[model samples]
Target chain A: MPAINLLDKFSRFSDQWSPKVIAELNGQAVKLAKVQGTFVWHDHAEEDELFFVVRGTLLIDFEDRETVRLEPGELYVVPRGVRHCPRTEGEEEVWLMLLEPISTKHTGEVEDARTVRTYDRL
Target chain B: MPAINLLDKFSRFSDQWSPKVIAELNGQAVKLAKVQGTFVWHDHAEEDELFFVVRGTLLIDFEDRETVRLEPGELYVVPRGVRHCPRTEGEEEVWLMLLEPISTKHTGEVEDARTVRTYDRL
Candidate 1:
């Protein structure tokens, strides 16, 4: 496959809270998302989730630990089974590149309206 | 684990062709590398590798395909069992973020001087 430009793939979509798949390797999916507001508080029972901020800032709130704030060029991994929620302060959307197992759910086991069952490939 | 800044991890190490592990999730290692010159031709037998360029340019030469060029904010994945080599055009150093299985060898099965046995965790 050809090289995928992160910015170019990001420019193709504008949906908030929805992540687009850019690439996959070693059973992990590489995704890009434009996020605002807050996501659901849930835990992946078997998969660690990687969050890499591409632009703006992201705040990951946890149920039992202190919230972690992520900035551009920064990355954080929420271990499996850790309850967490990701959000963006104010009205600005946060751009992110995420890595997770292909079987990971969007909202874990929680039934939410924003949960996406299938990720669209860019 | 704490949030990892790619640039901060990159600043702490100046070793060429060696990758520093910044994070690991789902048995995959997220690494940062400062690379110059050309790498040896090799292929992982059972693992795919993702290469995301942080700075400068990278050229991936394949055995049966045309070379792929990657730039900042661009990413490419080399499928498992594909013989490929990574290189740079000039003497300028290239910053890269790599994602691959933790068990993957640096130069695959190739025994080279630049091969790293154990990756330093940054």
Candidate 2:
């Protein structure tokens, strides 16, 4: 397969909150998503989720701790079973690259309307 | 843990070919490496490695396939058991982010002088 260019991938879709799978290795899926507004407060029971900001600002609000803010080129790993919510501030949309086990549900068990079980491969 | 800035992490080290463990999750390791010259031809028997170019150019030469060239913001996955060698072209050094199983050996089965059995956490 040819190299996957993140900028080119981001140009292919405009949907918000729906992650597009770009690659998978070792049972983990590498995804890209455009997120705006606030996301549901949930956690993967057995999978740690990695959020890497590609553009804009991402603020991850936690239930028991301080909210973590991520800027471009920065990444944060939310441990499994930690309740948290992610949102963008000021920016119209936030571009994010996520790394998580394939078994991880987008919204965990919350069943939010924005939850996407099977991501479309980009 | 605080947000990890890839650029900041890259600034913290300048060693060539030595990968530094930045973050880990789901039994996988997220590492950064600055590579120059050609790496030894080797393959992980049971682990796929994802290489993302952070800066400069990266070229991956495979045993039975065309070489893949990667630029910044581009990524390629070297499948498990595929003999491949990575090298930099033109540029003095290439910065890369790697994702692979935590048990993966630095040089796979090869015992090269540049092989690092233990990676330092940055």
Candidate 3:
């Protein structure tokens, strides 16, 4: 497999809230997504999700009213079964690298219009 | 859990080839290491390893004589049970983020003076 360049992959798509799989290792899929506005509250039943900020800032709001803010070159992991919503604060688009199990659903247990069941492999 | 800043974590250590765990997600450990020079060739029997270059460049050499060169913002995964060695060229030190199983041994099946059985959590 060739080396995956994060920025080059991000330049391929412009859709928001849609994840594109870049690589798979140890049963986990490494995905990149361009996100803006707010996402729905959802939780994966048995998979932990890692969010690594590649560009811009990201705010993750939990059901308990706790918020985790991530900047570029930072990462945060949301444990399984924790309901959270991810969104950007301003007009800037956020570039995120997500790591989760291959079996993980795009929107976890909650499916809405923003749900992307099939992800394109970049 | 607090968001982990890659640069801040990297600033806390200067040891080469020693991995410092920063986060644990889904039974997998996220580690950071500053590496220079050559490392022993080893392979993990039951775990795949991911190498993400945070700064500088990295070269991964496989037993089959294949080499993968990674630059900043690039990532490569070495499949399980593949004999490989990681090294950096020139005088610059490479910053790397490694993802592997929690139970994975640093040196794999080979134990030598450079082996690190216990990694400090940053």
Candidate 4:
């Protein structure tokens, strides 16, 4: 039998930044999302955020002159307490799985227009 | 800049079962692989092992008569102390990243045909 497609699961929903809970491990939530354009600059003070890209591209910009572009199948672990912003180039849609504490906020510290209120599940 | 491709990183080595160390976080090792055929049944007494599939499929057969099939982009976390066997159904190659303690063994208890030696780096 074929297993679940992470992107297909995201396609079932339309909310951005509101990651859907997929799996859990040792108290950490594994979330899948379909993201486009730019996300607000924020920081996860208590936990590191892992961005594993499944399709398209993403550029993670940190506050301190650190900018990393993620390609398909590449994963970047943003350490806890670092300020960062995410943006997508072109018109590509990105598939991402974030591993972190379940209570992590969609936007940290700076209140902005892109903060996701609630997380949805598929 | 484009980030490192996990599968391409595995292409830099030719060892089977012997996983190559990739990134590290909070003292945890993230190792990637290109696997085919079957892996020896094993159990990690302390740390859970996460298998994130990048290409093709995998059948994880557990000792309790339970089986879970994983496909591309789907991740499965094998809880600590659980014995399981992994097998590929066809000639397809599979990409995996195993997250566990650095001291964990490739094989659990039973002396098998697929015990890997020392881990490699790419």
Model 2 alpha-carbon drift over 4 Å, by segment: none
lDDT of 4 by residue, A76-109 (tens): 8888898989999877778787777667777866
Tell me how candidate 1 scores on lDDT. Answer: 0.95
Query: Residue A5 in candidate 2 has what lDDT?
Result: 99
TM-score for the A chain of candidate 1: 0.98
TM-score of chain B of 2: 0.98
User: For candidate 1 chain B, which ten residues in a row score worst on lDDT?
Assistant: B1-10
Could you tell me the fnat of model 4?
0.38
DockQ of each: 0.94, 0.92, 0.88, 0.42
* Residue B91, model 3: Cα distance from true site in angstroms: 1.9
- Lowest lDDT 10-residue stretch of candidate 1 chain A: A16-25
Q: How well is candidate 4 docked (DockQ)?
A: 0.42
Q: In terms of docking quality, how is candidate 4 classified?
A: acceptable
Could you tally the backbone clashes for each prediction? 0, 0, 0, 0
Model 3 quality (TM-score): 0.97
Report lDDT (CA) for all predictions: 0.95, 0.95, 0.94, 0.76
lDDT by residue (B1-122, candidate 1, tens digit) is 77899998999999999999889899999999999999999999999999999999999999899999999999999999999999998898999999999999999999999999999999
Q: What share of the true interface contacts does candidate 2 keep?
A: 0.88
- Winner on DockQ (1 vs 3): 1
